[model samples]
Target: MSAPTEVPHKGLITASLMLATIMQVLDTTIANVALPAMRADLGASSDTINWVLTSYIVAAAIATPLTGWFSERYGRKEVFIASIIGFVAASMLCGIAWSLETMVLFRLAQGVFGAAIVPLSQTFLLDINPREKHGQAMAIWGAGIMVGPIIGPTLGGYLTDTINWRWVFYINVPLGAVALLGCAAYLPHMARRIRRFDFIGFAALAIGVGALQLMLDRGGEVDWFNAAEIWIELGIALSGFWVFVIWILGTEHPFLEPGMFKDRNFVTGLVFIFVIGIILLSSLALLPPMLSGIFQYPIITTGVVMAPRGMGTMITMIAAGKLLRVVDARKLVVTGLLLTAWSLYIMTGFGPQMDSTLIVVSGFVQGLGLGLVFVPLSTVAFATLDPQYRGDATALFSLVRNIGSSIGISIVTLLLTRNTQINHTELVANISLLDPEFAARMSGQLGGLMQSLTLTRGEGAFWSVINQSVNAQAAMISYVDDFKAMMWVTLCAIPLALFLRKPTARPAD
Candidate 1:
């Protein structure tokens, strides 16, 4: 039961949809850097401050199941417009909140409504246009979604450093207003049969997804398996996810049809999307802290360095969109993964002596990899899915990507934390056992003995200085080793791609 496609002003529809998606995507990362300033202003703890991010993600995950249902029950145009208005108002509230709790609550409201814009925008764009050109629609829309994070932190860093963090929220107002107005005026009312809302499915999905994100995000921070709250959350997540699957399987009408997951190509496309999601976001998330904290880069400088990745993506997306009509998508993905692996290799080569030139090169290469793979993957996905099923597929794709990012960040953060401790420990142990020759030489330099700066003993503190030097080098080794581990993980995509289907010269029409 493929939905009949509509004729459209391909260029204009593409513009409006991509603009909406860009605004929403930007909101996801822009507030992240502002969290520190938020902490200072609200006098909150670091652990508590992370709720600004976790709440937003959890809200989106909980509310995402409604996106396709709403689009079908109402009109895509109506839902899209309402989403823009809701997101804008929430952004205003976020900027003006007087307390940490208020700001977090407002962000939840923002995420709940804001969750639909990205997938729906893409869904709408592809639906209105000729099926063969959906890849072009994806190209236009992906430029916004894929490039948002790259731009967000730099923009956030600049705003926080130069003016105020409130500007991050304030910045969303104009962009969102324009998008809302444009959508209201220009978005088409494509005629299609709508379905009844699935109340039971919605409840199960909310319980399952909300509990899952809550547990994953808070569990590690709270010391997993030790807290009573976490175990309860675990129970909710398993029950909800498993039960939702069973319920959706039996329902005559579901929020998401159980049949959508049966498409081999759709399943393959999802795996690739998740892999790319993890690679792109985890890298962006790690870069700001690594550059500013470890490498002594300023906020603005770190943000600026990461900007090349966005630039590369923008360039490659348009180029790859045109190529999808000619190239095999799986081959493009394979090539893109190798390029991504190579780009990560470039990143791996960086050490304590890294400079702007190296950062720029690595970011640009990685961006190229993203752009090359993303467009092709997107084009092929819709090519195989009929219009009737596009909404279902789109929602699932978005969910996988979001989950991938959560998993990616959590894994990287934990790895860095543990490795830092191990590296520091080994460093301490080796320093204590100082080489026989080096110990003698160090002792001689310090005038023949160990001292704790007690002048009464007539001794100098020499061995401590040597130990300090040893500790510093060990710390550097640890950071570098952790970085190498991340680079290796980037290669994980290659094996995953082996299962992808062949890409043809044109999208299905």
Candidate 2:
């Protein structure tokens, strides 16, 4: 592989690629807010409907490692254009899906086509831009990648509310078409190589990623290790990973090149992004439900309140891009981690009756942290690596981040469910006939109400209100615990930044 040939329409190329990047990243979180609507429309059960998301996630993870090989065998322009077309077609199919099964299948197809977009987009942007401007380029790129997840729910909610859940998928059509045209017109046809396909490595990696994703996605639903299916998935994930490790170490041409990982900065960046993925995406996953369920906000209102988060990230990313010229990248990462941890800590203190201001403020702060970290981290990660490795390295980077996000979402969701149950039981156990404190509390709050309804102590109506209150409180506590856990995770990322070496200054122009 040689250095990227210059394209005359760099601006058009960048815009087109960013459009595709945003379109793809938006799908990651956009479907979440519409899940209820989908369940109702498709007449699917809670457990089964989630395959709409799970299928896409698993398919994308399995196919991501193919980017390098695809780009190598076929030129980058060919693969990218085909991906856009395929993804657009899949989105249309998803929009028109008549059943849950069809929806899952369409989503899986979308994932497979969309997997190459991000890594290829990153690689293309890096290739077009001068080394000195990598920070600025990554900032622009990072804004699309990072802010899409933040904006996804709000956009999904608005579309779902105004039109229908199908519009969530339909929205991709026009965007994808425009991107495809721009890419076709502006992106250069890079040279291709006749690289040998590493089938064994790919199969092993695919099995490992596919199994791990399934385990993470379904573990909570089936009670983790207690279920035979969960145990089987776990065993498969471990076995696949073990095989992949051994195969990669020995294979001459592995699915991923071995030398890519040998770069210290690149390796450390992987760990950094993984932890960042866990905290960043997991918080986004937790917020909407908390707003709708705990605070009782409408879907549109939840989206509106969350808008500030993306704004914060957008503002800081541009600033971080400029600051990279004057500041140490490692310091920026550390600062970002502190801000994220601080926001999470604030979240842990949220009261059940708190106003939306807290949500907005903490979200904004977290967004700022994410922007500061993502721009510099991306710029610095590949600063020292060979240009030829960019395709593979970027793919692996995206894969690790996705895996971390999957694991993080699953962990918090599981903890929230289990902790709610534990807290509910404890609260219920203390609400007995002998406890005067419980009696006084219940009587004071619902005395007149119960009297109006002719309800006696320990009656269904009386206990029903009490139980609802207990459940709400328990869920709030569970949410707070999740926040605390995320804060610690953010704090833990601080040490990893120490391992990253600040790139030396480029020569004076």
Candidate 3:
């Protein structure tokens, strides 16, 4: 909206922006832990309960690209303030929703209104701060973006356990109010432009993004391509994207400005952010289930163990902010990637018997790595781009990162499910009376137990023990496999850092 220059009340402005950003980002994962409680209260089936999440995700995906156009046409300050008001109102509506249908509708409204807050906040920070402080600015911004999701489940779980699931949504009320006031009072007004909207292009892109999100969110539940619904969604997604690309390339005034792609640093940064999103959110998606299902961790303990990751991220992000002043941004990115890969490699060593120590350690290391990367990546992505395209660029940047997160979570989850089944089958196949080791064990500790009970009871107990052991081992192996796969993904992203050109030095204001 506004050019990068000296601005008054920068501190207040940043605080306001971050509040809104955190409020919006927190909702992304905060509702996850409350799903079960919601399911019971709303009288929803297991299958239908997920619409609470899917509705928000799809609505956000479809609405996000509009941020650029809305900000340009309606003024960034006005749109941002309106988004906060709408989001808070929607949160309240969600909190008080009486049925599944109403909850999904409220959540969709929340997503649509909340979609613009993040990108606009980023644009504001970039606009308010000069180029030299971009790393610091981004570090502040990155902390909220990264740490919000990390703490979301913990907060949600705590609220749900202490009070009820409704508090999860209700909690946003006070925070949103403060943000709304701060923003309305201090956010500078940007002049609106009278540009023509590209309805066709916007429609096509929205369809593509919406369909893609739906496909990803529904695929695992529906057995992926085996379900006709998944196939239809996939086809629609591909077709929508193809048409959008073709339309945008040919249109005089495209929905997104094509020139944004010409910047090497910005383009490269998108690729990196996409990968970061995968690593960040997918690991988060995997950890809770692994902890609760395999380790038998209660919600609070799982939250505590997971808390270190966010702490690590916050610590390094601040450090990286300062580090950017002296170090090469590309070098910092490479180091971050290596550190992330190293953490994932450690995770590959996970076992059913291991304690939380390894999980905490690996998570912290990964957090450090992500923090090191995020600030510099955010700074560099916008460093070489023209201010005119800042709105669209930031929106696109967020969209790509989110899409990456969706795709990543889907892939890892699918792999975990399939691999666990395969591992379970293979492990079961190895068990036989003819195998000497199996027979020895059965005769040793197993023989004593079997002797302690009747024939029918002993046989039942024996098979139950074997099944439980097999299932745990199989699931653990699957978790490790997912970790290994992500490690390779982190490693693969390292070379892309080489393609980033250091931003040319900017003159002092």
Best-fitting candidate, measured by TM-score? 3
TM-score of each model, paired residue for residue: 0.90, 0.96, 0.97
Tens-digit lDDT track for model 1 on 444-475? Answer: 75434454444544343555555665554555
lDDT per residue (tens digit) for residues 1-509 in model 2: 44454558899999999999999999999998899999999989988999999999999999999999999799898999999999999999999999999999999999999999999999888888778788999999999999898888889988998999999999999999999999999887767878888898889889989999999988988898889998898888888889888998998878788988878889999998888888878988899888989889998899889888898899889999899989999999999999999999989989778898999999999999989999999999988888778878999999999999988898899999999999999988988757888678657756666665554554567667778789889999999999998898788779888899987642221
Q: CA shift at 167, candidate 3, in angstroms?
A: 0.7
Q: Considering only N, C-alpha and C atoms within 3 Å, which residue pairs clash in candidate 1?
A: none
lDDT of 2 at 480: 97
lDDT per residue as tens, model 3, 1-509: 45646787899999999999999999999999999999999999999999999999999999999999999998999999999999999999999999999999999999999999999999999888888888999999999999999889889999999999999999999999999999988888887887789999999999999999999999999999999999899889999999999999999999999988888889998988898888766998999999999999999999899888998899989999899989999999989889889999999998889899999999999999989899899999999898888889999999999999999999999999999999999999989888898899879997777666546585678678778889999999999999999988888888888888888853232
Name every residue pair that clashes in candidate 3: none
Tell me the deviation in Å of residue 94 in model 3.
Answer: 0.6
TM-score for model 3?
Answer: 0.97
**Root-mean-square deviation of each candidate, in angstroms?**
3.6, 2.2, 1.6
Off by over 4 Å in 2: 1-6, 455-459, 505-509
Q: Which candidate is the best by lDDT?
A: 3
